[model samples]
Target chain A: MENLYDVVIIGAGPAGLAAGLYSARAKMKTLILEKDKAGGQIVTTNEVANYPGSIDDATGPSLVARMVEQAESFGAERKKDEIVKVELQDKIKVVTGEKDVYKAKVVIIATGASPRYLGVPGERELTGKGVSYCATCDADFFTDLEVYVIGGGDTAVEEAMYLTKFARKVTVVHRRDELRAAKSIREKAFNNEKMAFIWDSVVEEIKGDGIVEKLVLKNKKTGEITEIDAPEEDGTFGIFPFVGYIPKSELFKDFLETDKGGYLITDPDMKTAVPGVFAAGDIRHKSLRQVVTAVADGAIAAVQAEKYIENTFEN
Target chain B: MVILEKDNFEEEVLNSKGLVIVDFWSDGCEPCKALMPEVEALAEKYEGKVKFCKLNITKARRLAISQRVMGLPTILLYKDGAKIEEVTKDEAKAANIEAMIEKHI
Candidate 1:
């Protein structure tokens, strides 16, 4: 007989860890399955200042460590495995991973989302050397140096603002004349002292030897091309792209309800169209994709999973 | 525990009272995995009042195709055994789902 769990959570991110903590504390046989290491997107981030009630100057890795510790202390069993298939139609949901198969009465999904890249030249080659997608992670490396941010949305602007704290100068490079970020965010960007704009331009090439040293920029309006060089002494600059993110929903595309961008759908209680299966975090379509919100979703999902088990199992 | 088979989905949904939310999902979808908890929470919160269930396309591929589910994490809302609303995966949020339930309930 397969080992049965009261609740099986996918993805060991903030949401999944929170769910595990709640479910395990409730005395449920909770199992959290992660494809890779724990921490999800938070691992990629350098620091987290926005999470309410967070520790002062809490780094992303530190935050994740605390969450993992909390969940484990509550008796949430975690396994590093990738779930390859599922049988959720039955009363006992079956999840199959790369190595084993397990059964659970309830399932919680907190797989989260991944950053989308421009797929332009040198972007992939110079990822860690000078190109980065997370300002929090790479900002400190560019202390007193110049950095360029791509895109014009909320994330792009927000990251640029965050980068300004460390960088000597921060320039936002957008292909559009007007920013697509929220009004308040745009106002902040416009007001920031260290922030500069490269409007109606796109990065045609990210050129560097070992680190990012120069960028070939193309003006969208005038079709003019120019090579922006890194400041002397520093010898290199940083590039952070914040265009958008792609939700990891390809596996469930055939069955689950998804939007054009492939985000998952869930109800207030986190219920999907199917019973016993729930979703939370960045994977679900929502306005805010933050750690605090993901933790809240995990808490709600755990409580709901308990209810689902009681309703289904109790006579 | 209710054992839902392919042949009994319609009967189970129709016989149930209040609202019924169905999740159509498959394996290998990260977003589907992420949304699972929210769906479960909703089902638990409205356990008696609403029917919450998930359909795995990997197991019920024919049914999923019949329903014309083109994407993952598709949520269909049913009230009194009748289809009321359909929400795409990206639009499936607690607030949005609550609004739909409020409209029907």
Candidate 2:
């Protein structure tokens, strides 16, 4: 088709931006479509430590800004569009954003996942007030306040420990009697004086006025419900849930091979079961979900897309 | 882009003859800072069709309070003199802003 881009990348996080950079560098016509800001979830993060070769004391926004500049400098065009549909059954794929439609030879899916919510009452309304998913973003707001963290996974426990640095006390409320986090992480949480745990329990509701004031917890073993109020003089408390993430793969479910959790399944080369279509970042069914891994996935998907186009259409 | 103040809130936004988008932001709000570039870009693209403006809450706290604005980076879409939609939390996203514009203007 006329004016078809070589690769159209969905989302503008590290993975999508990296793919754009690689595809553009390979002399392919690339366009990166982002539903939100350029940085994705990383923009909410205040600091990043683990990414290799990152500058000392690098912030998440700073890191993402540099990556985006590099990608655009290499000739990747970026646009803001909320994609509503996709037609992936043909050699040349069709992707529809709310504002525009696009045709592409290859499509890279990197619409990253978001943190899973607890689905309890008041949780949604109190999100920015006192409920948060990322401690890195909202921890400082809760300094010296009592906080409750819900989950048993590595991220939950790890974040609980991290919150102790800001909150006066952090109580971990998990569904099971024990934690599912790594042993080392568990040890750190148990030893911390500011950290505590509520076993075999789940939060039934989060109640607050203009801010979070109380939580209703249910003891799974005893079938008892109890109300935990914010400490006197505090008037409100913080609730941080780190249950896990839900992949942003609803639009591609019928077209691409995906795991039960809705994460797109891709080969090691980032190629999906459908030829010329690839998946990357947290949307991919992979182990690590960090900036480093996302960048690597993006690079591979672009290079693979380039090879696919060269072999199929060019020569 | 219009810089909204307490005195011009009515004339520039409410009493305007066209569709208007007023971004209520603060100086140190990181998300607001992150969204300004996108807002500026959209202002250029939507110039003459839709009005884009900003009001610094730090300078116009009374106007912000009068509008019941509880958070930073709140984007309000106004059709003529009536406020139609408000994006309070995820207003930093350009797509979300664009979708609102597409839905109305």
Candidate 3:
């Protein structure tokens, strides 16, 4: 087939782009298919301090741009198409996108995760009105207003801190008494005067009329419920949820074996159970999900794919 | 696509006749910036049939809120000066916006 590729990676995030850089540099005809524009979830993130070897104040989009440039320089072709189906059992995989179908000797699945919603009432109806997942995207809308952040993880704390810059008061509501974020981030959150915490609590419901007007919070341990109404002057408050993520594995769930959390199961070398099919980045079942680890997974998956192609496809 | 300011928003979108799509964006929103070219391409495709305009929320905060746009990268489809549909955040993908345009136009 004219569209046949040595390796067709299924995303343009950190892992897929890094895989492109590696596999293409190895002289493989690599193609990276992305549903959206490049950068994935990282693009929504503002700061990326923990990425090693990054220069001072490296932003997520800047880092992804460099990665995209490097991958393209190495001759990795990219396309913007959402894959609707995948036939992975055969020797030659057939990936069907909305625009076209592609054949590949080796397929790297790098479809990443998306922000998990709180699933509380009114969250769906008022998503654009007041509830948001991307702080960098919506912070400016809440300038000088009160904002509530949902979650206690790294992203939740970091985003809550970021919201403090725009919102008058930023409060983090966690189901646990203590935060699950890193020590340094926890210390920073504790020290910020504008930041506050609602421990052992979860949002029971978000109430609004045309916009976010009130939030009903329930304490997990004490069984106490409290309702916070929007300030009369402002008429609305912002609710940001950074709780967790849901892997974008809906397309491959039937063909691939995923963990309980829907993360694809992969060996140490990023090889999935299916031959010639590998999974990497946030989609893979791993202990840590970070940019550094995702890039490492991508590099390993590419190298392993090359080895697999040499042994199995060469005849 | 017409870049709208507070002064001419009504003239360009609300008061305009037929179908109109407004891209609610800002300088700091990365997705909004990334989706710009795609939106512009759509504008070129549907040139005379649909009116496409972009508003920077940073410069027109009150106007954006008045239109009930509280999030970034929001695409609102207006028919006869009334908002018929909207997609925001992750739903504001190029394919989805294109589908929205096709459905209304």
**Top-scoring candidate (lDDT):** 3
Question: In DockQ, how does model 1 score against the reference complex?
Answer: 0.01
The better-scoring model by TM-score among 1 and 2 is 2
- DockQ for every model comes to 0.01, 0.17, 0.72
> Superposing all C-alpha atoms, what RMSD in Å does each candidate have to the true structure?
20.4, 4.8, 1.4
Candidate 3 per-residue lDDT over residues A1-315, each given as its tens digit: 788999999999999999999999999999999987798899888899999999999988899999999999999999988899999888899999999999999999999999998898999999989998888888888999999999999999999998999999999999999999999999999999999999999999999997999999999998999999999999899999998999999988887899999999988999888999999999999999999999999999999999999999786
lDDT per model vs. reference? 0.80, 0.85, 0.93
Span of ten consecutive residues with least summed lDDT in model 1 chain B: B64-73
TM-score of each: 0.67, 0.80, 0.97
* Cα distance off (Å), candidate 3, residue A108: 0.5
Deviation (Å) of B31 in candidate 2: 4.5
Every candidate's fraction of true contacts kept comes to 0.00, 0.06, 0.65
Per-residue error (Å), model 1, residue B61: 53
Tens digits of per-residue lDDT for model 2, A1-315 = 675899999999899999999999998999999875787777656557779999998877889889899998999999878899999879889999988899999999999998899998998887766787767645655678899999998778877887898789999999999999888889888899999899999999999876788999999999999899988887777899888899999999987888989999999999998889999898999888999999999999999999999998986
